[model samples]
Structures are given as structure tokens and as C-alpha cells.
Target chain A: MFRTILLLILLVALSYGFWLSPDFKEISAGVAIFLFGMFSLEEGFKSFSGGTLERVLQKSTDKTYKSIGFGILSTTIMQSSSLVSVLTISFLGAGLIGLGQGIGIIFGANIGTTTGAWLVAGLGLKVNIASYAMPMLVFGVILIFQKQKSIKGIGYILAGLGFLFLGIAYMKSGFEAFKASIDLASFAVVGLKGLFIFTGIGIFATVVMQSSHATLVLIITALSSGQISYENALALAIGANIGTTIAAIIGAMGSNIVGKQLAGAHLIFNGITGLIAISSISYLMMGVDYISIYLGIADDDYSLKLALFHTIFNLIGVIVMIPFISKMVVFLEYILKDKVTSNRGFDSAKYLNDSVLELSSTAISSILKETKHLYDNVFEIIAHGINTKRQNIISDKSIDETIKDKYSKEKVDIDEFYNHKIKGIYGEIIEFSTKAQSTTISNEDIERLYSLKLACRGMVEAVKDTKHLQKNLIKYSNSTNRHIQKEYNLIRQGIAELLRSIYIISRTKEEDVVLLLLSKSKVNMEKYDILSNGTLDRLIRADSISDEMATSLMNDSSYAYDISKNLISTAEVIFGDVENLGMAMSKEDIDLILDKKDN
Target chain B: MGIKKFIKRAKEILGLEDEKKESKKKSLKRLLKKLIKRKREICTMLKDKKSKELQEELDIVSLQIKKGKKILHELYKSN
Candidate 1:
């Protein structure tokens, strides 16, 4: 409701301003074009983020300094701090980076955004930049029409740069023209009162624009044209810094708790930085003048001076806040805690979110993580449904001993467990996967996603199979018939062994060990089917068990076989090498290895 | 060189020709090396205290090593 009212007010104001002055219309159009350019630029950059950018982000954000450096470097290259913030939140949601690391990146991005001021005041105002805009737009549009992903990405980038240059030229001319008609400098207030008012204006403009970079560019252009006072521009720059956190806060809205914590950190950091800047404005301006003189910027060059001031103050903010990131993390955790949903209510997907859906690699990474989360629940559910404890399976105990450790005397409520733990997440993974498939990802990623979907299906199937096998497992494990009891015990042993193997495979870093365990589990899975091995036939022929016992044993054995097969295949899909693209081993490969061994 | 031969050579240079086959061969070689090492370790363990599980593992590793080697050889031969 508030957003709608604001939008209507903005439209009325814009229309009224356009009627009052054509120059106002031009400046507004320039800002519009500039914002559109920023959007295009971010879109262009995101196209390549499918892999290379993702890899760099993962490798670079291991430490605080490195995370900050990554934040600065990526924002500088993409020229959009908002994009970096969104990506950081996505990474947090996917469990890719920690809160401290995220804080570092946000700090770096603050410093990074100052480079835009330097670019605008130094080159954009000086050069005949509109001349460059023409060819770039032409080439960019041409490339955008191409079929290849990279080409289209390049197209958007080129067109984005072109539009930005064109927008700047329009804004500069519009301001210069508006100066002749009505002196905006006359409207400028002075001293602390002026500082507070302009700072408020800066925050409001940036909040509405949603890009501090855009708001900063506007302040710089207006300052260069003498339409705004130098002190007011400085206040606006400080306000823009504070307003930028609004982007992070908005990005955090749909993200997980970690993302929200990082956004809170961004807000608190920037707010404190803004307060420090406003309180010490005189000292900062003197320092800026001293540095500007040392750097040979003229006394009248308020625009360049503003850029220097922007960089220095943000650097000070980062320096001041870096030491407190940990404490801030604890503070944010205190105030805005994650809702404790795990203990009560239907368990939902943790990693799947709108932010991660921005990049293909992130989307896939989060989906894979969510699948593992689902599998964790599956492991516990299947373990307990079989009357075997999860702790025993994960322990370094022998399968014989592990299978003997019962989860409970009574059968576990599999239906209730499934509804509580598995169903909601399974539905979400499928829905998110379908949504992700429509994005600009490669067919290979889509195939991998399909395989992940299959893995989820298999996990669900395994749980259902456990439910079917549970009744008989409980009944026969305690039966007086020794043969039936022994067979049921063997079924438990086979499942326990497979579960142990999968757990090992998921944890170990060694590819060789993973392969060996997967292969070993494949071999062991064959042992679950007594019907195939003729053990069932011998038991029947020897009259060791009754016909009813034999039938029950046969059906339960089939379910055991299915449960083992599904879980093994799920492990292979989720934990397997990327080179395989989730391609499971064929039965022929297993049989060939087995047949040669038998020979 | 002719266009086809030039293109083929370029693909080879780029490591794009029969990419799946090359990757499979590489995977097989890696698996075989590991399998051979595991088999040796199993054999060494068997000498001190023989166990049915260890024996079965030795057989499985040996069979995999042999099969991987054969497949890898076929991949090379086809190339």
C-alpha cells in the first residue's frame, strides 16, 4: 500500500516537473536510461557468472580480507554494488560463505562503489562520451541478437555502457541548461541544517532509485554543473552510502536467516559509518583537500574532491567496522534470530530461494545442498523404520553389531515422519528445479538437475520401501522360526552395510575411496535378493520355513533390494563427480565386473 | 591441410574432439591406478590375517582394475 502511494506520488511529481521545465524531463529521462543501463550491465555480468564468476567467488572469499577484496573487485568490474550484495546473499543462503565473510564483502563493495564516482567525475564529465555511445549501442544490439550465450552477454554489457554514457551526457546538458533558467544553487541550504536536509534527500533518492551508484553519479553531475553546492554533494554522497544498504536489506527479505543477518550487518555498518562521517565532516573535508592538493587536484575541482572524499570516508568506515564484524554478527544474531522451525511444523527447504535462482551454478549448488538435506532426513527415517538406530549405522562398528542395535522396541511411525520431514522439501526441490530449468542454463546443467530430481524420487521411494519392509522385518526378526528370523536379520545387515557405505562416500574427499565404496555397495546390493541367489529356493525346498513365511520373506526381500538400490543410486547422483553429470553406472558395467570376477 | 583435417587438428588442440571418450579414459586410468593400489594393500593384509571380506575386496578390486584397463585400451584403440 505504501509502495503504491509512493509510486503514484512519484508519477505525479514527475509529470508536474516535466510540465514546469523540459530540462527536468531530460534529467529524469537521463536517470531512467542510466538505471536501465545498470540493469543491463548486471544482466550481462550474471550471464558469465554461471561458472567462472562463481568459481572465483568461491575461491576468493575464504578469509575476511579476501572476501572484502572479492567484493571490491567484483563490484568494480560489474559496476553495481547492488548486484554484489544480491550475490552475497545468495551465497549465504546456499551456505557458500559465512556472515563475517559476507560482512567483509559488503565493506569492500562500499569502497568499490566509490570508483564509480571517480569514473564519472574524472572521465565522464571531461570527455565527449556521447560520441562513444553510438557505436557501442550499435555493436551491442548486434551481439544481443546472436544465439550464443557469451555473445548476448557481451551485447548487454556494451549496450549498458553506451546507455550510461548517453545518460551522463544528457544529465550534464540538462543541468547546464537548467542553471540558466533557474539557479538550483540558490535553493541550497548551508551549515548543519543544510547537511541534515540534503542527507535526507540523498537517502530518499537512493532508496527510490535502489542504486547508490546511480544516486552518486547524479550528485556528481549536479555538483559539476554548479546546480548543487559542494557541501551538499558531500552530504548526498554520505547519504547514498547509508541508502545502499537498503538494497541489501531488500535482497535479504526472501533469503534465509544468514542472509538477513548479513543485511543487518550491512545496515548497522553503513549507519554507523554515516554518523561518523557527518560528525567529523570538517576533518574529513580538510583531509580530502590535503590529499587532493597532494594528488594535484585543483582547489576549484570539487567533483574530483568529492570522489576522493567518498573513497577516504568509505575506507575509514571499513577500517572502523572491520574489527567489530564478529561482535556485530553476535548482535544481529541476538536481535533477528532464525525462526526455530525444525523442532515444530513441516520442515521446509533451507537452500532453495529466489536469490540463488539468479545464477545457474548457485541454483544448482543450492539444489544439490537441499537434496543432501533431504537425504539426511531420509537416512534417519529409513534407519528407524527398519528398527535400526542411525547412530549405529554411522559408527565405526561392524555391520553384524550395528544391525543388532534397534532404534525402538515398537515400530517407528514412518507415515508421520515422512509427512513431517520429507514431503514439503521434496515438493520444493521439484518446484525449484522446474523453475530453474526455464532460466538461461545449459542443457548439461538441466540434465544434472533432472538427475537430482531422480535422486529425490529415489530417496522418497526408499522411504516408502522401508515402510513396506518394516512390518515384516519386525514380525519375522522375533519369530520362533529360526530360518525366517535369520533371513530377516540378513536383510537388516545388507541395508546397514549399504547405508554405512553411502555415509562414508558422502564424507570422504578421496575420489578413489568414493568409487570403491560405490562399487562395493553395488556388489553388496546383489546379496539382498535371496531369490536371485537361490537362498530362498533352498529354504523352501528344505522345508525350513512355512509357505506363508516364504511369501513374506520374498516380498520383504524385494523391498529390501529396492531400498538398497534407490539409496545407492541417490548417493551416486548427489555425491558423484561433475564430469559424469550425474550419469549413473549401467547394470552392464556392474555385471561385467562381476562376471569376470566369477570366472 | 584441408579444412576437415585442419578443423580436426584444431579440435584436438582444444581438447574438444571425442571429449567424453577422453574424459572416460582418464577416469578409468585414475580408477585403475587406485584399484591396483587397493588390491596390493588387500594382498598384503591377507598375508598376515586372511579374512573372507578382505578376500572378496581383493577379488572385486582386481576385477575392476582389469575391466578398466580393457575399456581404457579400447578407447585409445578407437581413437
Candidate 2:
């Protein structure tokens, strides 16, 4: 609400300024165009952010210095610290990179942002970049309308650079024209009072713009045109540094706990940096002056001096934070404690958070873990649903004897168990899978996600089939007729054995043996199904069982077969290795292979 | 009377009226027939594939099939 009110007020103020003076209008327009260019550039870069970026990010952030260098290099090339910050939060949330490494990248990003100030002050103010911008825009728009992603990405990059140049030209002229009408330099206070006031203005400008690089470029342009004093520019630079954390904070809002903690680190680092710069303002200005003299910069060249001052202060922040990184991480971990709720006998999703969606592998892994969780719960329910204890079924105890002994026990409400164990988690896995589909992921990962979803569906169907068979199972299990009672026991024993075999296969480490066992299990089910049909039909034909009993037995036998088949298929998805899963092997593929062998 | 007539007309247009019930039942019957046919084909294919794959384990399966055929013959004679 406060942000909305601030935005409304800013809009009204800008409108009033535009009406009063054309110069203010041009400056505001320049800022808008530059911010738009930033957004376009971020979009363009995202096109090439496939597995390569994630691989590079994972491999590069192993050590502190390498992570910092990565932050500096990427931020310099991308020219958007906000993008780097968001990626850091995402990586941290996905557990791909540690918290301390994330902090290091953010630190390097702050120092790297000074490159924008240097570019604007040194080249943009010197050359008529608008001339270059015109041709780039024409070609960029042409490429933007092309079909390919890479082409469109290039188009956005060209157009973004063009807009950036054009915006800089507008701001330079706007400040130049404003010098004739009004003297903002007259408003600049002297001493520490001027430092505090200008710093406040700098922070407000950056918070409103959401980009400190934009704020810095604006400060440099205004300072170059003599609209703002050199001392005031330095102070505004400090404010801009501190205010950029708002973007990181906003980006982390929808992310997981680690993201929020990293955002906290960003604020703390920037605040401390700003305080140090402000307290020793004179000393930093002296250092900047000394550097300016050494580099042969003119005393009146406040724009270059301001850029130097920006770099020095950010460097100071990084240097100060270096000694206490481990301490900082511990403090952040202490402050942002993970929320622990009662287990309640149902497993909540461990890795399926919004943050994991940023990376495809992370998203895929999270889905796999959550599916395994659902399978575990389903394991217990399916065992108990068949009127056999899971321990007895999986143990060396004969499944036939176990069912024969315990068939008279009270039946488990398969429907109730489905609701309690499978329904909520199944919904979450599907929801998470559907949500992950929208993210930029690899084709292989998408296939994995879809396959996992189907596995969950198969498990649910198996449970529903069990529920259907439960009614007749209870009725015939205690029947006075010997033939019908034995046949029902066969149905229960068949399903229990299949479940037990699958449970064992899922835990085994030997892939080849697991595959062979799974195939044999498939054959075993077929054999049992054939036997059940024959035995039930023969009992009815002998006039040993009634027609109703025979019909129910036939239907229950089919249900048992289906339940076992679906459970085995689900196990293959959960337990099979990527190489042997043969998810890529379709009927058409098998036929083609067989044709080749035949040839 | 006017509102009732309008609602009835709307239901007819939307295919929610009872007059559309016969066609709905026919379509449902057609779907069930298609499903049942598919199920039988799948069962036949499954039986053949498993018999072939379970070569060493086919002894028990053959006995089961032989028994089922004998009972099926008895059922047909009784009918």
C-alpha cells in the first residue's frame, strides 16, 4: 500500500514537472527509456540461459573468490546487478550454491555496477551515441520479428543497447538545458549536512527506479552539466548503493527461506558500506582527489571523480565483509530459522518450492523426491489394503500363509487410506509438476517430469482398483464355501507378493538384477492371472460355487491383476535408472529395432 | 410463464434438455463398447507376450491355460 501511494505521488509530481518545463519531461523520459532497456536486456540474456548457465553457475561458485569473480564478470557483461542478485537467491534456494557463496557474488555485483558509471561518464558524455543508436534500432526491430529464439534474443540485445544510448543522450541534453533555466547546484548544502541530504535524495531516486546503475548514470550526467555539485554527487552515489537492496528484497519475496536470508545479507552489507562511506566522507573524497590527480583528471571533472568514489566505497564494503563471511552466514542461519511443523504422519513436499523452479535440474529432482514420498505412503496403504502387514509381505514369511491366517481381520478402508495418504501429496506433486512446466527447462527434464506425473496417476488408479475389490474381498474371505474362500485368498496373495517384490526391487543397488527381476515379476503376474481365471471358472463349472460367487471372483481376479500390473509399472518409473528406464523406448522404437535385427 | 419458457428454450439450445438424453445414452454405449473391445485385445496381447517371455516359467502357465479351457468347454455345454 505504501509503495502504491509513493508511486501515485511520483506520477503526479512528474506530470506537474512535465507541464511546467520541457527539460524535466526529457529527463524523466530518459530514465523511463533506460529502465525499459534494462528489462529488455534481462529478457534477451534469459534466452541463452539454458543448461549452460546453470552448469557454469554450479561449477564456478565452488570457492569464495571464484564466486566473486563470477558475480563481477556476469554483472559487468549483463549490466544488471538485479538479475545477478535474483539468480543468486534462486541458486541458494535450490541448494545448488551455499549461502556464503551467494553473499560473495552479491558483493562482487556491487563493485561491478560501477562499470556502468564509468561508461556513461567517459564515453556517453563525450560522443553522440544517438547516431549509433538509430541504425541499431532499425536492425534490432528487424531481427526481433524473426522466428528463432536466438535471433530474437540478439534483437533484444541490439534494441536494448540502442535504447540505452538514446536515453543517455536525452538525459545529457535535459540536464544541459536545465542549467540555463535553474541552478540545482544552489540547493546543494555545504559540509556533512549536504552529504546526508543528497544521500537521502539518492536513495529515494534509486528506490523509485529500482536500479542503482540508472541512478548513478543520472547523477553523473547531472554532475557533468553542473546541475548538481561534485560533493552532492558523491553523497548520492552512497545512497544509490544502499537503496539497490530493495530490488533483491522484492525478488526474494516469492522465493524460499534461503532467498529471504540472502536478501537480508544484501541489506546488511549495503547498509554497513553506506555507513562507512558516510562517516569517512572527507577521507574518501581525499582518496578520490588523489586518484584523480594521479590519473591526470581535471579538478572540474566531477563526473569522473564521482565514478572513482563509487568504485572505492563498493570495494571497501567487499573488503570489510571478506573477513567475516563465515560469521555472517552463521548469523543469517541463526536469524532465519527453518519452520518446523508436526509430522502428522503425512509427508509434506521437501523440495517442491517456488525457488526450485528457477533451475530445471533442481525442479526435476524435487519432483522425483516428492513422488518417492508419495510412493512410500502408497506402499504402506496398498499392503494394509490387501489385509496383510507390510513387514510380513516383504519378509521371508510366506505371503499365502500370511493372507490365509489374517484374511478374517477387519478390512482397511482403502478409500479412507487413499484420502489420508495419497490424495493431498498426489495433488501437490501434480500442481508442482504443472507449475514447473512453465519454466525454461530441458526437453529431457520435461519428459522426466511428465513421466513422474504418470507414475503418480498409476499409483492412484491401483489404489482405486483395490477399493473396488475390497467389498467382495471381505465378503468371500469368510465365506462358508471352501472353493470360493480359497479362490479369494489366491487373489489377495497374488497382489501382496507383487507389492513385496516391487518394494525389494526399488531398494536394490544392482541395476541389471533389478531390471531382470522386474521383467520376471511381470511374467509371474501374467502366470498368476492365467491361473486365477482358470481356477475360478473351473470351480463354477463343477457347480461347487454359485453364479454370483463365480462372477464376483472373476471380477476380483481381474482387479487383482490390474492392481499388480499398475503397481509394477509405477515401480519401474520410481526405481529404474535413467539409462535402463527405456522411457524413450516406445512401441514404434521397439519395432524399428526389431526390423533392423531381422534385416 | 415467460421466464420458464425462456429457460426451457435455453436448456434445449445448450443440449441440457431431456430430449437430448437418448443421444447421450447412445454415445455412452458406443464408448463402453469401444473400451471393452480394447480391453479384450490388450488381454490377448498380454497373454501371448507373457507366454513367450516366461519361456522357462511357462510350465505352470500352460497347466493353468489347459484347465481354464476345459472349464470353458463345460460352461459352453451347460449353456
Candidate 3:
């Protein structure tokens, strides 16, 4: 409600300003266009993330230096530190990268943003950029209409650059006309008082723009137009750096705990760097001038000097804060503890955070990971439901011993386990998958997503089947009739063997190994089907078991068969695609293998 | 020549006529190579162990190699 009122007030103020001065309206339009260009730029960069960007992000960032380097390179190429920070947060929320690595990337992004200032100061101010914007816009719009993803990505980039150039040109012209009417330079205060006031203004401007790079570009254009003094511009740069953390903070609001910790790290890092730059302002100016002279910049070139100062101070900030990253991670983790860790039981989706929903690749990766997490829970429930201990199954113990070692003396509440462990996470996976597929993801990713959703359903079905099989499993295993007891025990051993094989498959990365184990499990499953082989009929005809026992065995065996089939199918979708290798053989092949088996 | 005809001719000459088929053929060849190596290993292991598991593995590997080779053949034949 308050936001509505504030928005209404802002609209009225904008209207008033537009009415009072055409120059004000023009400048406002320039800022709006610039912000829109940034959005387009982010979108353009995101289009490429389905391939090299996402792959590089997952493969790189093993070391702190590599993480920082990735941050700098990505931001410099993309020309937006805000985009880099948001990606880092998404990566963290997806559990793709660690907190220390995320902080390094944020640090590198600060330095990377300095390249934007250099681009604007060194080239944007001198060139007639608006002329270039026209042809770029034409070509960009044409490519944007193309069906190919790469071409569309290129279109967005070119169009974004055009809009940015046009915005800068508009602002420059507006400032020039405004200078003739009113001397904005006369309003500049001196000493620390002016520093504090202008710094506050810079913070407010960047907070409104949500982009320090934009704010810096504005400062450079204003300075080049002789509308703002050099000292005040320096202070504004510091304020812009500090205020940019708000973007990371906002990005982290919907993300998981690691994302929040990274945001806190971003805030604290930028805050200290801002304070350092402000306190050492005179020394930084001297350093910038010395470097400027050495590099042959003119005495009148305050804008380049400002860019130099921005780069130098951020470099210094990274150097000074590098040692503190480990300490800061400890501090942030202490402060922003993951609530999921403290609350035990009733498992929720750990990797399905909103931040990862930004990209289809990240979304697919997270859901795939969350499905494995669901599989973990299903393994436990199925192991316990059949009265076999989970550890014994995963162990290298014999099947007879694994079946002999029961999970509990009392029957586990299968319904409660289903509700507590499986249902909530399964519902979340479905909801998140639907949300993901609704986005502008490609058809291929959508197909992969559909498969992941099916895997989740299969896992849940397996657990429900285990629930149905549990009652008779408990009753018949302890019966006086040795024949019925032996059959029930064999059912337990069958499931135990399937669970162990799946556990091994889930852990191994070798496709051949996965294929071999899957084949073995299928053969074993067929071997244990007593009803299909007439073992149950043999027992009844020979008067070895009663009629009631036969009925129970028939029903229980079917349930057990379903349980094995569902879990095996689930494992195929989850663990079978080892590096996209065909780990799961076709049903025709499996049947052929079983038929040729020399028993 | 017209632009579309020129492009289509260029793609055929460059062996980029159909990207999916090209990649599938490449991956199938790679898998077939691995399966052949695996079949050889299983054959050796069977000579040493005389185990049922080794024999089953040899059969599966041989079948997979046959399947991959057939797919690769069809991919070329259609082209």
C-alpha cells in the first residue's frame, strides 16, 4: 500500500517536472532509456548462457583467483556488474558455487565496472555516439526478429549498445542546454561539507537507478559538460560504489542462505571500500594525477582522471579485502545461518531457490539435483518399509545378511514418512518444474524438464508401493510357515539388492559401470519373481503352504515387482544419463538379455 | 545463384547439412569404440575367471556394439 502511494507521488512529481522544464523531461527520458538498455543487455547476455556461459560458470571457479577472474571477465564482456552479481547469487542459490567463490566474483565485478567508466570517459564523451546508435538499432532490430538464439542474442546486444549511446547523447545535449540557463557548477560546495552532501546525492541517484555503472556514466557526462566539479564527482563515485550493493541485496531477498551471505559480504566489502576511498580522497587524487601524467592525460581531462581514480580505488579495495574474504565468509555465515540446516527432518527442496529460476540451464540443473535429493529420501523409506537396514543394503554385505539385519523392531509409519520426507519436496519439484517450463526456455530444455518431472513422479510411486508392501512384509516374515517365511524373506532380499545396486549407480560416474549394474539389477529382479516362475503354485500343489499364504504371496509379490520397476525406472532417468551416455538399455534389449540367460 | 540455393549448397559441401545427424553419428562412433574395448576386456576376464557375471557382461557389450554400429550405418545410409 505504501509502495502504491509512493509510486503515485513519483508519477505526479515526474509530471510536474515534465511540465516545468523540457530539459528535465529530456534528461529523465535519457535515464529511462539507459535503464531499459541495461535490461536488454542483461537479457542478451542471458541468451548465451544456455551454452558457453553456463558451462564456463560451472567448470570454472574452483579457486578464489579463478572465481575473481571469472567475475571480472564476465562483467567486462557483459558491461554490467549488476548482472554479474545477480548471476553469482543465482549460482549460489542453486548450490553451483560456494560462498567464498561468490564473494570473489563480486569483488572482481567492482573492478570490472571500472572498465565501463573507462569506455565512456575515453570514447563515449568525444565521439558523436548518437550517429552510431541509428545503424546499430536498425541491424539489431532485424536480428532480434531472427529465429536463431545466437542471432537474437547478438541483436539484443547491439540494440542495447545503441540505446545506451543514444541515452548518453540525449543527456549530454540536455545538460548543455541546461548550462546556458542555469549554472549547475555554481551550486557545488567545497571541503568535506560538499563531499558529504554530494555523496548523499550520489547514493540516492544510484539507489534510484539500481546501477552504479549508469550513475558513473551520468557523472562523467555531467563533468564533461562542465555541469559538476571534479571533487564532487569523485565523492559521487564513492557513493555510487557503496549504493550499488543495494542491487545485490535485492537479488538476495528471494535466494537461499548462501545467496544472502554473499549479499552481506557484498555490502560490507563495498562499504569498507567506499569509506577507504573517502577518507583517503586527497591521496587518491594525487595518485590519479601522477598516473594520469605518466600516461600522458591532459591537465583538463578530469573525466579520465575520475575513471582512473575509480579503477585505482577499487583495485586497492580488492587488494585490501582479499585477506578478509575468508574472515568475512566466517562472519557472514555466522550471521546469516542457513535455517534449513538447523531444522532437522521433513526434508524440503534445497536447490530449488528462486534465484536459479533465472536461467533454464540453472533451473534444469537445480531440479535434477533436487530429484536426486528426493531419491535419497525414497531410498531410506523403501529400505525401512521392507524392514531392511539402509546401511546393510549399501554395504558390501551378502543379500541374506542384508535381509537378516532389520531396520526396526516396530513397523515404521510409512504414511508419516511419505508425508514428512517425500510429499513436500515432491510437490515443490513439480511446482518449480512447472514454473521453469512456463518461462522462455527452449524446447530441448523443456523436454529435459519433462523427463525430470517424470523421474520425480516415479520416485513417489515407488515409495507408495513400498507402503502397500510393508504390512504383509512384516507379518509373513515372522510366520510359523517356513515356506511362506522364506518367500517373504526372498522378497525382502530382492528389494534390498535393488536398493544397493541403485546406491552404487547413483554414486558412480562411469557410464559403462552404470550400464553394467543396471543390467545386473534387471536380471536379479527377474530371478526373484516367484509368482511368474510358478514357485508359488508349486508350493500350493505340493501342500507345502496354505491357501491364505498363497493369496498373500501373490499380492505381495506383485507389489514388490511394482516397487522394483518404479525405482529402477526412476534411477534410469536420474542416474542413467552418465555424461549423456546411454546407461539404460532399451526394454527390448533387456528382454533379449533375460531370454538368452543360460540358467 | 539465389541466396538460399547458395547457402544450401554451401552447407552440403561443408558437411553441415544436418547438425543432429552429424552429432549423433559422431557420438555413436565414440560409444561403439568404447563398447568394442569393453567387449575385449570382458573376453579376457572370462578366460581368467570362467564366471557367469563376466559372460553376461561380454554378451551385453557385444550386443551394444552391434546396436551402435547399426545406428551409425542407418545414419549414413539415409544421408
Top model number, lDDT: 1
Indicate whether candidate 1 or candidate 3 has the larger TM-score.
3
lDDT of 1 by residue, A1-599 (tens): 98799899999999999999999999888899899899989988887776667778889989999999998998888899888987887787777887888889999998998999999999999998999999999988987887667667878999999999998888889999999999999999999999999999998899988889989989999999999999999999999888878866876777777778988988998999999999999999999999998999999999999999999999999999999988987788799886765557678898887777778888999999999999999999998987888999999888888877787888888999999999999999999999999887987789889989999999999999999999999999989999999999999988888888889989988766787788778877774579887999999999999999999999999999999999988988888662272223457756765665567
lDDT of 2 at B9: 64
**Whole-model Cα lDDT per candidate?**
0.86, 0.77, 0.84
Candidate 3, residues A1-599, lDDT tens digits: the string is 97589679889999998898898888788888877888888988888777467668877788888888988899999999888887888788778888898999999998999999999899988999999989988988887887767667778999998898888888888878878877889999999998989888888788878889889999998999999999999999998988888766866777777778988998999999999998999999999999999999998899999999999999999999999989998899898986655435677888887778888888888999999999999999999999988888888899998888788888899899998899999999999999998877988798888888888888888888888888888898998989999999989988888899899998986666677777777766766788767898899999988898898889889989888888887888888853244435677877787777745
Model 2 CAPRI rating: incorrect
Shift in Å, residue A141, candidate 1: 1.5
lDDT of 3 at A119: 90
Of the pair 1 and 3, which is ahead by lDDT? 1
Rank all candidate structures by their DockQ, best first, as comma-separated numbers. Answer: 3, 1, 2
Native contacts conserved, per model: 0.24, 0.00, 0.16
Per-residue error at B18 for model 2, in Å? 59
lDDT (Cα, tens digit) per residue for candidate 3, span B1-79: 9745645574566344475467667766766777788888888888888987787777788777777677678789998
Alpha carbon lDDT of residue A132, candidate 1? 97
Which wins on TM-score, candidate 2 or candidate 3? 3
How well does candidate 3 score on lDDT at residue A565? 81
lDDT per residue as tens, model 2, A164-275: 8888889999999998999998898988898999999989888889999999999999999999889999999999988888766876777688888888999999999999
- Candidate 3, superposed: residue stretches over 4 Å from native: A339-345, A540-543, A578-583, B1-37, B68-79
Which residue ranges in model 1 land beyond 4 Å of their true spot?
Answer: A250-256, A341-346, A578-584, B1-36, B43-79
